[model samples]
Target: MPELLIDIPSTFVERIERLAAEENESLEDMAMLLLRRGYDFAVTRPEVEPDRSQRPGARSDARLDWWREARFGLFIHWGLYSVPAGVWKGRDWPGIAEWLMYRAEIPVQEYEKLAAQFNPVKFDAKAWVSLAKRAGQKYLVITSKHHDGFCLFDSAVTDYDMVDATPFKRDVLKELAEACAAQGIKLGFYYSQTQDWHHPDGDGNDWDFDPAEKDFAGYIEDYVKPHVRELLTNYGPIGIIWFDTPKGISEEQSRSLLALCNELQPDCLVCGRLGNALGDYATAGDNRIPEEVLDLDWETPATINDSWSYKINDHNWKSSVDLIRKLVDIVSKGGNYLLNVGPTGEGVIPQPNVERLEAMGRWLEVNGEAVYGTQPGPIQGRADLRTTSKEGVIYLHVFDWPADGQIRVEGVAAQGARLLAGGAALPVEVSSGALVISVPEEAPDEAATVIALR
Candidate 1:
């Protein structure tokens, strides 16, 4: 199917204006609300079939299968803010790098000045992809464009891009895209849909619900659309469009943006933050993991520390064990876990983040079978423990060890059982009620032991 150019019809605009007047909301706010609804409609309607020609190497089923199997991914929050590298002047900034301008209340002009000094001399895209792979991550989502409004790629749409405006003068997105393709890691772009503080039209003071901005619709047509086109077309194959901040967009605008993305990159997955259901997957905000699988494909994105971008004084980092457990829990609940890493100003990932990822990787080396290529178990019970299955093989991830060497697994119909990490076969005896298995005196893994059922 060809790309459908989304132009808000005049009648729909009139209805929205009337609704806004009735609700005492600005026209922009009403439009945004409507767009949100439309997005939900698009996501839920299922009227639009996926374009098969655009999705390369796999059918829709295969892509969905691969996505379901890939329960873990690495999210990098790096950009011009990385040049500040978590510090303002000689003082350590405790906030995320991306929000440095907002936290410091530095005007956009002053923040753009950092572009002159934003040269990532040691920035290696291959190394970044390699790190993610080593961490046992199947996909990589980087900020192609953040709320700060700087484009990582050479955008024909704007002069305020990495290759054109910054000292780095490199197309980071192109490099990363190539690296991801080479490494067989799915590449995703994090594009902020609404707040582009740098762009004149993106000025939050006007368009956001707080203050009315003039000609907001014009901004979307001229600036946002062109940049999005650049992202979808210039990049070889973007796996996902991770949109954020749908503040002032109309429902029609949101639908148009999503439709355009699908038209350009038909197989590409879109996130829930597009202010509507125009996305393939739902996104749970920072550090939020839903207790139940959201009845839709979803991913929980969380930072190692409080900040998405590197912060000099933010020593708070999640332990390797905790991170691994989070991954296991998320997968067992049938969701993807996206762990974030904020790189320092000099373009190097902080040592702490690297160490944590490496430690998780070490654990993954042994118990990864329980993780990758597995689906959620049928039985959702078992406190502190979860199960995943593949090829009729059930993996019981024991979060809490039993005092005696026995753990009761209800509804396990498998005839044989073994330890995945240790490879030690266990005696499985079925009682009148449930199947009981004798675990080893010591657990195979300190965090979680995988009991493989055959």
Candidate 2:
């Protein structure tokens, strides 16, 4: 026996081992055979490779105009982990629900059993999209697949999907796609490309799979590429492909995935986590906002509560005021806000989550112009305040309340000033080389108030 190490999931080695055992051959011979077989599964390849010989992670910059303006979106993390809801074997798990498999180190045999009881009768795709629309989210990005290796959509590459393995046979992705289209919302898919825990050839689950079983090339050819193709072809007009937690993939492999996406859908936006920093835009640290402005295109994936996925013990919900301020801060710093909501196993967005979203939507109803289609404020590094400008007009976001009726804006000479929520003009004057506006006795909005200046 020879040691065969690979960069792919541990399970891929098991697959090659099984192949070797079935043929009564050595591991080295099986490795070669696996690579040969992988080289041949070119079904996902386009008949004619487009003339897109651009560098790895290359993308069409002009195609993301809509994405640039879509300052807010909803990120949903739903899968079998919701079934466990963070409780495994009657013991409470602390982290996010989606990481149940990896964190708990549960074997694939035992973890797959979760599908038997997975039923989301309350899951309504239409309602989900409708809520997003009302919440002022320009798009919706849901977890098509998470690290647990469970597929929420119907994947031909594997039968361990919502339509096949789970009791709920409905395809969640299909309904979401249809609903998003009907509601005029852009839809994107979040996939855990390198961290699938379910498929025998998928990555992660080192406890169940040996080192030799991890075949990066084999998994890429047999599973990853095909899954991307299925999502691209089966779903109509995907806005973006969000690949997360890049660990096992190489730079060349990452580039190949990017090229494949560019080939299939030239205009599709790819997130930076696809590995090797090869993506259309940048992804920020989880649930965090950048204090200073970023020169490159970036986005912050935030949570309505503390956890990205459903957690029964996690009640640290961000207030409507807090979320509004956070969104303003992100957009002010030249970044998009990707807020998350984790539905329960029963398929319902927590009531608290819905209420907070609706509140933000209500605020947007009055102050959308201040957010949408705006650029970074002329002034930078204002913690208590932010500015977004379009054309000659600038909107000042007052995150804190002034106990007095007077407010001052530095580094700006205001030609005029008015309340954004209402069309009321406020007296403005430049004093001490700063723009000052006269506000009311109290803050107009509990979250933040926007003032327009010309």
Candidate 3:
């Protein structure tokens, strides 16, 4: 189908204006709806959703079709950093544990010794996948190789990998992939494309390897590209290749790797950090969500706790209510939420993270229709009420439930309304250009109450 270019007739404009006035929507918004009606496709008010995914453009968008629908994902950051647990020299280190190597300024020789102690005996891939699945995450992205150059998967390129170096000589990634497949969850790899602190030719090791002596291109060809090839071919149908930290990768260098990924798995999406701004979907700033609705498929990677990796001292965990609200906010803005959990050295998800995930899962069990496979509603920027629509039904996610029985939707008209948590009919009235949904005095869920508007 061609793009939806609305060329409304002069006579139709008057009719649309009346309808817009009735719905409290802009005349232009109603006109877009009329235009899209002639051709079936979703249209966002204020701005029409462009056919960036299907039309002739970057191949990334084409592959992002499934990702947009996913809406939620699990991000695992586990490695030797888990061994440190944010402690260096018996002193508590601050910030993310994944940055342990750089933060503590540990040399390659000393850091290599930690692998011998890297025995995650309790690490069960099935359990991890099950946890993520229960949390209602459509996909899981684990750190295959972080900036520290410690490989979780069996890598032929270096002896620094789990299989080659670790005491628990099992391929963490292989098990994770198999487990994800068995549990019917999509899996992706978060490979550190640049800034391999352990490798001499890799970026971000000025103390160990001199920049002048390092061969950046050779590092890409020998280690980075080949390792990526191994991951793609070995893993069964990867959803994404999440490359992170663009230290020194040029545009051409990044494209070369993306091309390799495309050749291997045509549908595999690349992270936005895959330097040169070439990726399947846009990645929002770490732990940051959009202020308003976004037309493109973007994702916000958030940590369950203060640190991406486990820290004994980092007790600051996001409450269940906060996580649920964040999820709702991201979904309302037409974006996916990739919540991170850093496992302990023993490869255990912290108890706090587990509890919060279960809580979110329970909420999703009831009000999932408002999230999964839903598109952004016509209403864009509003904190009090966010919108997401599926088919013709619009979902009003009320952040602050109305104290009074009457719930007024400023610019929406609903045929009928029902509270999502419980199948109770919400008395709905379509007044002059507004939708009023009647609810109980007390809100069902304090976090975010969803009302289904048809």
Using lDDT as the measure, the top candidate is 3
Give the Å shift of residue 363 in candidate 1.
2.2
> All models: lDDT?
0.77, 0.84, 0.84
lDDT, candidate 1, equals: 0.77
Ranking by lDDT: 3, 2, 1
lDDT of 3 by residue, 1-454 (tens): 5666644334446667889999999986787777678566332212211211212254345467677778999999999989989998897876688887887668899999999989999999999999999999999999999999999989888889999999999998999999999998999999998889999988887667777899989999999999999999997899989988775678789789989999999888887778666767767767877678765667888998889988989988889999999999899888889999999999999899999999999999999989999988878787687889999999988888767778777777777888898789878877776777778999899888998988
Measured by C-alpha RMSD in angstroms, how accurate is candidate 1? Answer: 9.5
- List the candidates' TM-scores in order: 0.83, 0.86, 0.86
Model 3 reaches what TM-score against the true structure? 0.86
List candidate 1 stretches off by more than 4 Å.
Answer: 1-63, 89-95, 203-210
Off by over 4 Å in 3: 1-62
lDDT per residue as tens, model 2, 164-252: 99889999999999999999999999988888777666677668776567776888878889989988889899999989877768888
Error of 1 at 83 (Å): 2.9
Model 1 TM-score on a 0 to 1 scale: 0.83
- The window of 10 residues in a row where model 1 has the poorest summed lDDT is 47-56
